[model samples]
Target: MAGSLVKRQGFGTAPVFLTSICTILGAILFLRFGFAVGNLGLWQTFMIILLGHLVTIPTALAVAEIATNQKVQGGGVYFIISRSFGITIGGAIGIGLYLSQAVSTAFYIIAFAESFSPIFNYLLASDFNILVYNYRVISIPATIVLILLAIYKGADLGIKTLYLVAFVLFFSLLFFFLGTTEYAQNMESIPWDAKILNGKSFFYFFAVCFPAFTGMAAGAGLSGDLKNPSKSIPRGTIWATIAGMIIYMVTALKLAISAPPGDLAADQFIMQDIALWGPAIPIGLAAASLSSAIGSILVAPRTLQAIGADKILPNSFVNDWVSQVRLKSNEPVNASIITSVITLIFVIIGDIDIVAQIITMFFMVTYGAICSISFLEHFTADPAYRPIFRSKWYVSLVGALACIFLMFQISVFYSIMALIIMAIIYQTTSYYKEDKEGLANIFQGVIFQLSRRLKVFLQKADPDSKEDHWRPSVVCISSNTFERFSAFNMLRWISHKYGFGNYIHLIEGYLSRETYKEAKECVNRMVKLSDSTKSRVYMDTIVSPSITSAIAQVIQLPGVSGKDNNMIMFEFSKKKPEGLENIVDNFKLVKSTDFDICVLGSSEKNFGFKQNIDIWITSKDYENASLMILMGFIILGHPEWKNARIRLMVLSPEKELEKQRNKIRELIRTGRLPISLNNVELNEHKDNIEAKSIINEKSKDADLVIIGVRTEAIKHDSIGIFNGYEGVGDVLFVNTNKEKEIK
Candidate 1:
């Protein structure tokens, strides 16, 4: 069968509203309404109802907003949650929602048997002990019958039955209201006490009463079945909540005024005693329980089907099995059977109060997650998160907080248990191997917005105020580092000085579509290399036939204005490439763009252990001294070079050498190079040959060499073959473009 044909939609607005009403106005109203009124009195009973709705209203609004934001499918709450929070959290909450619905089916079926057992009490052969034992035994068959009816008839029959049940429920309420009127008139004779009647606190009553309002999710769970879920869900949920609230409040008022406080507190079957016709009470209970069971059974299996269809859970066999549908009915028959089996287990256990508490805890977490998604979407201000059903962020925040607060208020142990189960499920689902493409959950948007703001703030902050504030903002030509990985490694090390690096890959060809694709692929490879090397480098590719023009354009690449790339670097090959001369001629052009330049010459031998760095200084190259010293400090800051020694060597005549050494000392102090004056080496040289010989002899064993490069050296192609440094370690030739002294 086709997938589309297997997922059927038939519900309209009226059926959805009636289904929710029937679900919310379940057996609790018939069996437990007097318990609340008796224990908490008229005022507190109304307060509990109001508090419950306060939490649910935001959750309903959140659901409405999310439903309208996207196309909703079978999962209902699970669908919304998974779409908003991703599969892991969605799967966890999906399981929680499924279990809640399954257990809720049993809860209502047990209520049915509890109410139905009274009819058998009048049988001559049955006694009280038989009533107690047979009530749970009867629930097993009652649960099976409801599940079977749902499976055979499908949701259409369930909706029609809910319509009749809703009618009968209102009819029974009319008689209840009529019977209470006479007793209400004699209000002065009834004792009204608002205290702990049965050793249960206000919050305990609140927990039991809260589930009465949670049936709102029944309409939402029918999202896939609805004719127009986005339109129907908001309308049905809001109307049902309002209707349920009114019914609960009016029932609370009637019960409070009609019965003596002692009878309201002590009698579990107080509604039957107060009914105009005794059978009306059991009839209402039966209708409420059966209707609620039908709604829960309808919703539970669909939730399981959604989880299975999405492949959020680990077991693929279970996922495939539960997601299967009957071709003719287009119903989740397999999923329904699974739900029925789970419900049967709970029905046999038949502990109503404990079941209610557990159900309440699960719903609280589910509702809180919904509200939290809405709150995050609004606060994160993601453009894609525009929801048609607009709501305030603070309101959603309050709703989320209220749901969490009530969870603990109900029972801290159960609340903790719910959270632990969800966390474990989330962790487990996170390991599921699935391609999560085109999925952007709300938390991603939140992190994105925060990162964007932080980036802006960082760009505005001054980076030159202190040594700690200094960070490398570097741009290197890709041609200089391709296959010459030592150059890329140096760039990585320099960029590790706490800032950003960008690599520009300029394709020296006509800018055609194929060239653009090739350049893009090259940039991707470079980015992958950056990842493998654990470096923070961004790669950009440009196709331009003229390498010089590309370099010129790259030097002016726009960025956060003041924090743009402060330096441009290139590699000097031993045998210069074809465009090396032209690139050298454009050095002044690059300087005009306000970026300093550094050309690297990698040794044939690997850069040996990074134990020593040597900086060769000349009288004419004083302008590059501070930058070279800063580079040495930055290199030493890296972990691999942390113990590396830095020595400043001046090969001037002895008379001028002390003055040059003193100047180097002042530069070290001013630039904060973290080196001692004893590391400065001054040697006498009579001519350029002697100076070159002195550098080769003293720095031959060093791991790295730093020297100044002038335009004359580049014009002669002597930049790579620095005098007396042919067999040395890695070399860096610095040319200062800025006039400011290092401070």
Candidate 2:
């Protein structure tokens, strides 16, 4: 399933331990630790060690937890991340990780060449005329040899080389600890205290030294070759990390006392000076650097090969070529060529400090991602995510946060650049990737848990409480969904920001094998329609035998936003009112639930440029007046109605027109409605003129007209009360069960 799709060598845990220790003790330990000690002093150096391990140890534990939970495959950490986080995010980080590993190989090779500096200087003094330009002469050649070895002999040769180097690494440390120098013997007169140097700040030193502790993951690179990865990975990585930390603390103490700050700061080979045998220091440095290089070389290609096999790259041919392996050994020859090309370019640059900074940033991102995954797994409480080795959620959170904190602390520019690069990779991968699974899939369980808790909490809260601001929790049911979009558009606007809406399409049949399939298909179509409009409305299909039953079921259903649905809407076409009679028949059945009702009469013009809305209110419409005004304001919140204006038309007797106008002015001013006073007109109403005729004459040009409906009129006239608004673009007849205070 991972890394060129081939069988592995099935090596055991020893290789994991040896590979990691060799890397943990590599060039940084011998070359940079003394520099860190002399510059930051003993106490601060120890603090750096602790801080660095704060990131590594938790990450190591997270790695252990994740490794035990899944069947680990060839790409090592990449395999684990992709499987857990899904392909898009995994591919993004995998690319960054692959580059870090490849560049890391070059980093080790350059350090290996640095070990030959004394020999090169002697040759120059003896006039032997060896080619030299800093360490490039050695590094360039060494890079070529390492690449060739990796390409031809593969991981087998690399693993065997690790054992040999690990042995040499032990003696070198032993000799360094055994040796003592004149600088050390004279240090008894001086007080042991932490000193701050004038140049190269503490965090700078910390950043340089931080990469030393990151070697715990080196063993994980050999995941494809391991005999039993589940058993080996956690033990090897955790033990190696613990051992590395202890050794680093001891070495810092030794370096602090053995040499004066001046010698330790000036001399790159301060450890050699403190060693009993000076040559052993360089030999160990060479062994450690070479072993680290071999480890990186072994892993980098497999990650790239796995990425290719997963089809993360854009080109098909390139994917096929890079993913292909040698038939017998399962060696990723083509992927190694790509990795070698990257390594050679960086090696030719030949600056270890610059390369170290780049590696640090990428590795920081990788560690942070791993810790985030572990924390999320614990939070989601997924039954499938039960790992044999479990890490505390808080520990993983700390690790993730520390990685981010240290990244910016080290270099803010690099941290931002690293994040931007990863984002670009994620976007690119998402474009080419066919799978819909992404962050949503990763967070599905967390969202489920949150939603469940919220629904329960909202249910328990006092629904009768009047302290909360009034917002519609609306649900609309329609069999004429495809025939008219006015109701759906209204629902969308209601839920845009301040409210919630659910649109249910009525599938007129009992729930059964055939009806269920039809309902599913109808729901899918509604989903597509919802997406096309970028609506926030939740949609579904109700497979019930009658419109009344569907209405009953929908009213009983909980709101999508966790609050109880407070409003129900019915829609019918003005030209083809096929469901009007059924809706009129069920008005009382719905009215029994104390839900405010809206009957939308859709027009041929479909809300006519959607610019002007008129609200009609009489003296008897105290409850409906506030509801209509609120609905108008809420509809205006949507971008589609952003340019629309609301006109509140209050009708009264000729003498009471001024009184009604004063009340509306108070209402608008008190409630903070956007309706201008000029837009709030009080029209004189004669008792002889029909209300519908006056409405048709006044609001004929309006895009939408909202008027209040009394329960007595609805019960007396049934569907006839809704028939007189033929002149307006579209009409909304609203009724409320309770008073809605604007404030």
Candidate 3:
């Protein structure tokens, strides 16, 4: 169905230019510019024209840039958007765009009905009792005729009709500019700032005028019928946009000079009185309105057909119906019927004030999305995105921003409603459709570029600014990853906030092709595991020959947070401490880098509910006390530990217990730590008592026990210091390289 338009010889640039220009100078120019000039004055009206072009001009440039970069298929704007941003997000916006285009058919048809007002007034005066009181007499027939033409004759008839209307529109404007009124000849000087009293506000008029510029993309809707969309689209769209802006500026000026502000404000058809041939104004209005309606009728069905072809709708049956095309003529018959139904329903409603605002919001969102794609492509600097016609990044940025700003500026309620509708559509499509290509696929490249730039900036910053406060930049190495999750769990808690963590899975083997492939699988497994837990730790794999060699390689790895690693963590089971010797042997090498160390001794309980944490501090462990407390605080920052509490247990001689208790209290207060005084306990220990027995007896109920590790003990081969902790669920032995202040 989408390729139906490509079967023919295809149109040249003429239809593209005619379709857009006709819509650009349609009902708005004939019906509303006089009102704008009267309310906002000539200078302010000029500003409105410029402001509208601010959005349209950039959008034109963006469309040109994007069309040149890729093959634009049946959907036109929808095709360009879905291909760049992925189908799900693009489908969400495409639905809105299609509805707006469909409803616009009715909007223009109703305006065309307004052109019958002069005849209706004459009928009412002569006592001709027909349906002259109701404008639907004209609207309903006009709508049926147009729908029949679309269903039978298709785009071929629509393009031919556009050419005739475009000619009438141009002649009407010329006659209005040529005529000279008494007000213009008698005026001493032009009133550049003349406006009627109690007129509408600037934004109100802006909302009324902005849609005129939106027709610049009217040509893009014919992309499927173009011989070469990459060349014809840019040329037709840009030329129409500039021509429309210049014509509008001149039209505003002519209206200001020809008519008084009072008459212009009172009569929407004041151009009739100003023109040399008075009847030409109403004739032009009727022609422009019909042309725009025909343009919309031609474009809306193709958009719906393209969407159905992509299978974006939830129901397969509906998709099949909408995507069906006429075999010989290559026309979207079913889609045209749907578009007609939507248009007729809105036509019956007649008063579409609220609906019009919503349509405006939809157009604004589409324009913004196009500009965003162009800007992101520029930012990513992807080789695949090279376009022959390039738009400046700043121009695209301004266009995107203006669309968003003007959305709320036009109507805050409608803007929010439009966004909510798109979100709902996106989620619904995502649930029924399995599309891996999504907004994330595009953002991935954008995030990579951003991360690279930030890393370089941070690396070049002054080092002194970073040393004032300390946060953990931890690196964890493990070979028993599948065997236990304690190491990974710790990494997640630390990396949750205020820190960074990188976990490397150590495979104790030489690097081979098989090993490299296995390492990639291991990384994928780790990623799935991390995603399941919503963990923030970055995962990787290293295939080194020995645990010591892996540890040496892992320690040199930089932190993902763009900081140097300051802490290293290792894990082993308490029941089987086979990996402890290798870790102890590499302590000297880790110490040479001045990195703090944490060795986890896990048990069968697997941290046991994560409720209670016990931190044991001794008089001889002054250097490790601050780090141990900080680690506990950092772990508590994770939501998994939300209900958990920490107990700071201190051991000293009986005489010095009071001194140590006050010192701990002062540190907690100064650091603004969450620990209460009641949770801090002081204990008396004699010289004969061993530290292991005291920990086993006191911390039996603790889910986790944090105990200080001394360099002197490790150097002297005091491996007994880490043994005999069967009572506790898990134990973390913390060693600090230097004293860290609480502040």
Candidate 4:
């Protein structure tokens, strides 16, 4: 073993202390993905990571002093602030901290979701470009399965799962670092030599390094529930910060030596570049990333539970049993679930980098506040108040200043967003003074307690409002038989996932007039589904309106209640709608009372896993179509859409509109048409050469691309889209249909 003996007893450290170390590791790992900032000069990166240790040390010491001296009554941020400053400030801090941590978990889940992109593409196909695949289909299943697993088994399973994840990450990163190459080359390329940044400019870069220091604070965020927070919290905080700094320094040094800043920032996982380090490093790095993701899954929920326990959140949110060390697994079950749900929404919003940058800004405010307090405490001159392991006040001051300064570095847009978050918290907390406290306390912790109560009350009063899915359609019938309800059930799931609203249908065709009169009895039984489901339904009796123009008729009526957003669900048969399906050359229509004619297709059959559903892209559509092709490509490449393994590309021109994309999907279905609803980007995308290049890259591994003749003549040297201008010969490029085996 080429190991230098570094002492670490797996079980020796206080649980919180160990937690801090792991926490810092997780933060360091955060720097390894999605929208990484430039690696400042070598010396700058080095100083921040190295000096970051000195910075976090003061707050850790201050926490120890307060936790030990203040008589652990509550020992949370609220308690810490009350003892140091006052209760009012503590209350505000409490609320803001809760939100900070809540939003922070979003970063974790987002990272977790993004980290799996490699695995997702690996499972589906190689060269997983953003525009080519759908990660939602891949991640949603994993997230849903995990979420359901967590909710079903309660909190215990989630915790146990996290522990396993930690172990995997530790070993994996170790191996990746060992395998990575060009370390010497990277070291030689340092932008500047060793010159420390002690001036004001430190702040912008400080923001870059702040996450390195926050690891200890992360554990402190969990102080209320720690096994022995006083001793444990101090040890964990101090050591974790040191470890984080070391990681930042080493990783920065390693990265600086290995690649240029431009390359480093772009790679995200610079350590996992297999072309440079051989393939083994990627696996190891992946393992490490997995570990960090799992840790977020475990600890992120606890902070929410802690907020609940303090009586800010609903008591129901604190359903877990954390009083005993053995039952800590049950401590914050409801809060965990809630956090998970909240995180899921952010994940669905896409863009992980934007979410993370916003989080860094949000949390920096809290970190700066904490560090400032520590600086204030450094001068109190009380023996008991002195930190067990205190550093100079200057360190804390720099940390605070750095935090303030770094907050500015995170883009003007994010700065505004961070302020908005702060404003929202202040407004909500002040508007509802449920948790009465003072600002002299811990910053905004008071607001936290009050907000929790209001949130809990709101939840109880209205659970339906929180449900983001569309309501299930009820096809009124006499019985709950599957044959009678299959269409309703299918539409309900599709509507829920795709945001399509419930469609109320009164069966009026095929049978005699007498039979149609009898169908009214069947409506009652069919409508039985709405009672079991929360989805909304429009009650339409099709007796008088003998369905004529299915497409045109459905577009004229006002949408059913709560079933509004861009989606209208209907119960039409596969063999049934000739009136609706035909003449509707550009789309399909059902006889309903709503008119959003641009709306296309029925409910997505495989809404979650949309990969098997082929998309037809032609050169012609690229020039004039309305959609963000790049974003679509990225969404399609999401790791969540694992089931979306097969993507067929049809490169026809004249059929470049919606009709063409749909027809290509028809080609893939082979007969009964196995696919999801047409997922076109409502927004328009340009057909520039650069965009085309990206498309070709996305289409590189495509299963099939059906080509149609181009409207214009093709130059001998140029490639042309078919079925547009005019052409006898057309090129059909099915990726899988290559003469030579694709390697």
Candidate 5:
């Protein structure tokens, strides 16, 4: 709910098309085109225009297709990305897109001020510094006026203004074409060589030209306002892209052929001199700049509003303030205010060249991500990803690669900076995105395909030949985990990372619909526990009159094909639980199914924070020794217990204590455990001392204690030996056989 909103539709295809066209035909076309043409010559300038569109068309197609497939709303590009990739990634890119749009608004307004500087010169007749300084003075007021216009009038007025700007832009283009034709007829020779002038590479010109085509997202950012976004987005976006490409190619051809390269390269404002009417150039520049600024101010606030509503931003006060909408127009009033402040700062302090390059990098990454989403959706073939507008997966893949390639070509340092910034945002927002239900995105489909392939590969492999690759596959029985949480936590810690656990809860009633319903509810609770503990647990429930029979049946079944359950575990209380005798009788039944046994005895106090582990060693029961030490390592591997220290303790006669210590040290060294000889302790006492008493005395301070269970102990009461040591801490009584070896 925090990351989503409902939007009202108002725009149609004409407004969307005009908005996209006006944004692409920005002030840069008038101010920066001559620079690009002069540096790269005629054919290469044309290539830059064509290549920019080539990289952008796929992103436009991806946006249109994805917009049609979903119920699109105010977030625009961010909404599509989040819905496709989930909240974490969506939040990251949304912030970046929002900042880019805000900065673009200032960039355009500053460009507008610069275009009118010649008029200021005509009036003031002052030095260049005074005129240039006055540009900032003009830009601050211009930014404020646009922000107020956007907040009060909303996108409707923005679209209407774009309509007027589109007319002016086309009229100016007509005069430019007419004037260039006359100049071409008079000129005897044209410079056609694609040579770089003033030590500029093709990439430098490409960077300046790239922003010309990046405005395709303007229509996409207004997705929430479209009357029929599903139909209008594809039609409007494609037609606008085609129109911009044609205009760019035509303008590049005319600029290269009509003027001398030396003259074109000398003047950045050559458009004004070359136009049929000189004033029309500055007028067109002003119109284009204002229209693009208005477009950005209209769309950027909505993106901010979307992210704020979804609670992705860190500050709650800021989120609540920015997400507020005006009841009259449903305009992002507060978001627009925040965006205006950021734009004003950029206008005051930001350098146009540096800001332009940074803006290009941000947009390149955004476009790449869009194409990547489209490619993944097609490749994974998720049933929910059906779209009205479809394109080939390879096409989307190529588009994504091209966007990334061009980003580095433009500036590797800026590209890396943009990527690092997005990554940090992703990490921060992912920490706060708590709604798991909202995580249904394309990654789920990708993971599903990967898991399916892995299952196939595992099924075909030889089970016996891969014994060395085996890890623990455990089946644990617990009626109510809350009542025995320590036992459950112990099982989770032991099976963390390298093993899988199947937790079964058996209902003590006749097999009826009511009992089955109750069992299912219990299973859900167990699943929640598994998620909270960050453990790999598959929960199952069964309604049976005989608890022991239910457990035995579950143990006999394999969790995955070709991987049988190798260990069965139960919780031990000092006072025997109900069906204790049946459980004891089923131990042999479990062993017949090739499973070892484990029982946990929990202390009354919660487990300590001290990371100390004690294991009691007697004779060389290598199987049990390996299993116990492995469990110790697993416990220490957890982030909370990373500092845990393990010790192998043995009780022996005084004369043989040294021999026992050497033997245990040799075992640990050969076993390659993360323990050392200093950790192996031998306790020598008189013949009157019992092994259990020795353990109780020595391991009282340890957080966890592990002791191997003999066959005789299993045959009698398994919980009796550990009764005196329950107060020490959590304890695991491990029994192992030669049937299965854990890797």
Candidate 6:
């Protein structure tokens, strides 16, 4: 359910709307103010921009084509690249894409801050610095705090917040265009001068417009998660593109026509001057800028994840829970926070001008690689892809060419800086690739091959193990405290991480208020434990007698289920062995070797508050295979003590045995527990050996030794569990995976 909920969340209409509007406003305004010495008027704007749009259109088309095949993953461009080429290529693209987005967020934040100062400085007493403007949008501390909260809380909450903010920005942009156009008495003429096209001015104009159009594919990536991706994505992309184009066209026209040439060329973000129309106009643009920045933050991380999955980059960078961390109801909260924090870095930057330079660098360079990939889709007979929405080869060719040409238009120095960073990243990534390949090859050939020659390598965690049919019977013991919290933590300590071992929890019986209070504390302590455990079970306390009486009574009463073969574990904190003697005495006569009891250490609530768990479990042998049983408990402590280990062992009668140990080694790979395993299987069956002799030989220096006991059927026998556990000796005998007797 958590998984399903995590998949559906996407950037809602508000983000899309604002992003589109911002696109229109930003494109138009920037194009007009950039004042590329292009003598071209309105009509020539089309041809100059046509080449730029060519560079951008392929990005969207390729994104859509890739999205169609692998839409649900939401890995974005990285996903497309990884699936077609390979994970190594994907990972590289992923890191590059994500870092690009991170850089892009910072750029937008600076842009938002820069756009606001001229309007704010005029009206407020606060003297905003124009010299070092972009970096100081909101206080950096405030922004960082916001970021931490978003991530600490997770993705669902963060995305919703961003979507709402973006919505407000959409209206702001709409109002900026509507507000400005409402007043302009004369429309600027469409000039068709060939002079503007001849020089570097056209290229520079294309360069400036490049970064503005990159965010539209963000919405298209949602196709996989959408209700109907094939239909919805195509429609959304087309609409979003058209929407972005309109905003760009209108804003540019307004800026060029209305502003005196001197004022138009005064600043890059001259769109902010629309406040001259009315006070409210400034508010809209400010809101729009904020939204644009947020929209970018929301879309970028998934791109990295998708790419990471394909192996083009380091898979380690991919976050498993990102798309799934539902915020309030369920939103992409993790991505939002990460994006926002990065955005804030740029926002508070002092130099507003650097904002444009960084933004230019992100789009110009990243897009070049993307366009190159797109070019491959057309030029080469690569079977890797088939376009869902094929642009004519000429269109694809022009887009790729245009993207390449725009790269040159950007300042050579900055372009060099971007390329150098990319090259270093590429080299570092290539080395890592070689190392990973080496490891894979070693594992495939050398390690296993050499293991046969090394005695030490052949030695298993357990030297002597019985034929494990893997039918280790499961016994689930639960009490009122079992699922309450305390036993939960204890179970966690008992279970191994990455999912290993068989486990059982003593669900103590029910009690009156006073005992309930005591039991809850015990349960809380158990739940708070940091030990590695796989599964936790609850025994019905009220089904029979209370926990204290049930331990005594269950032994005397006929056994119901798994009382014969499996050992039962009981946890209590009596310092002296006297209080537990009665518990042991009751079961002593049931064939002494039939079962065993274990006493656990008492838990201390030192700080009153601890990591997610409330219990602490310590086995004499911290490394135990029995820890695998604590899976549920281990998961319980996942909020904290995520890597808590469960050292465990299962003592058998025989001292030496061998069986399927390889499967056991691979069981707990999720990064929690490192298993330490050992086994002692007695050669002779109990009938042939003296009970004393068996006990001495089986548990010479064992931390815990559990055995099975005979069971009887009683009226309350339906409720089966680890009976006579509370008063056992140092060794603990637990039940099997089943509720049957170990006998």
* lDDT leader: 3
Candidate 5 pairs with clashing backbones? 2-309, 2-310, 3-310
Against the true structure, candidate 3 reaches a TM-score of 0.95
**What's the alpha carbon RMSD for model 2?**
3.1
Clash pairs (backbone) in predicted model 1: none
Candidate 2: which pairs clash? none
Every model's Cα RMSD, please? Answer: 6.0, 3.1, 2.4, 27.5, 6.8, 21.6
Off by over 4 Å in 4: 1-14, 27-41, 48-55, 71-79, 82-87, 119-132, 145-163, 180-213, 259-266, 274-290, 313-330, 378-392, 411-743
Name model 2 segments beyond 4 Å from true.
1-7, 120-133, 179-193, 260-262, 423-432, 436-440
Candidate 3 per-residue C-alpha lDDT over 295-356 given as tens digits, one digit per residue, 9 for 90 to 100: 89988998999899999999999999998878666678999999999999999999887898
**What order do you get sorting by TM-score, best first?**
3, 2, 1, 5, 6, 4
The residue-by-residue lDDT of candidate 6 on 1-743, one tens digit each, is 44553446444444343444354344324323335423444455565555556666666665555455444456555555555444554455456667766666555555555455555566454464434333363535435654564455433444455566556555655555655433245544533342333334555666565566766655543333445554455455656666666656665565555554444454544455553445434455445445454445545655643443334443454445344444343335555555665666555554545546655665655555555555555554334345566555565556667665666566767667766776777676776665344224323443444434453443433534643422221222344344234333443333323222123234344456766666556555544442323333322222334344554444343222222223344443323333334344444342233433332322233112322221111111123234323332434344344543333332223322122233334444442333344321213333466443544454444323333322332123322223332232233333223222111
* lDDT tens digits by residue: candidate 2, 199-281: 46879888888988878888887787788998899999898999999999988888888887767778888898889899899
Write the residue-wise lDDT of candidate 4 on 165-280 in tens digits: 55665565565455545544445545554322332354555555455456576555445444456666667666766666676666665555555556665666656662334433
Tell me the whole-model lDDT of each prediction, alpha carbons only.
Answer: 0.79, 0.88, 0.89, 0.46, 0.78, 0.46
**After superposition, candidate 6 runs with Cα above 4 Å error:** 1-7, 10-48, 123-142, 145-202, 220-225, 228-231, 267-277, 306-349, 352-359, 378-387, 434-743
lDDT tens digits by residue: candidate 1, 1-743: 64475556567788768878999999889888898888777888888988998898888788888888888877788899888877767787889889999999998888888787566766635554343456876788888788888789878788888888988888888778777545567667433454444556788788777888898878888887887887888788878888999999888877887776667778867777777776788888889988899899999999999999988768889889998888776688999989989998888887767767878889999999999988988877877776778878888999999998989888999999889988887778778835443235465777777777877886778855544344557787756547677667777777676556677777888888899889879988888988887875667787777768888778877442236678888775544444446557677778777678887767665568999999987887777877887787777867888888998877677678778877767766886555688888887877555555677788889888898776556656643435346657678888776433455
lDDT, model 2, position 221 = 77
In order of appearance, the predictions have TM-scores of 0.75, 0.92, 0.95, 0.48, 0.72, 0.48
> Which parts of model 1 have CA positions greater than 4 angstroms off?
1-9, 25-55, 69-73, 79-96, 111-135, 168-212, 242-289, 308-320, 351-433, 440-470, 494-497, 560-563, 574-584, 604-724, 733-743
lDDT of 6: 0.46
Please give the clash total of every predicted structure, in order.
0, 0, 0, 100, 3, 125
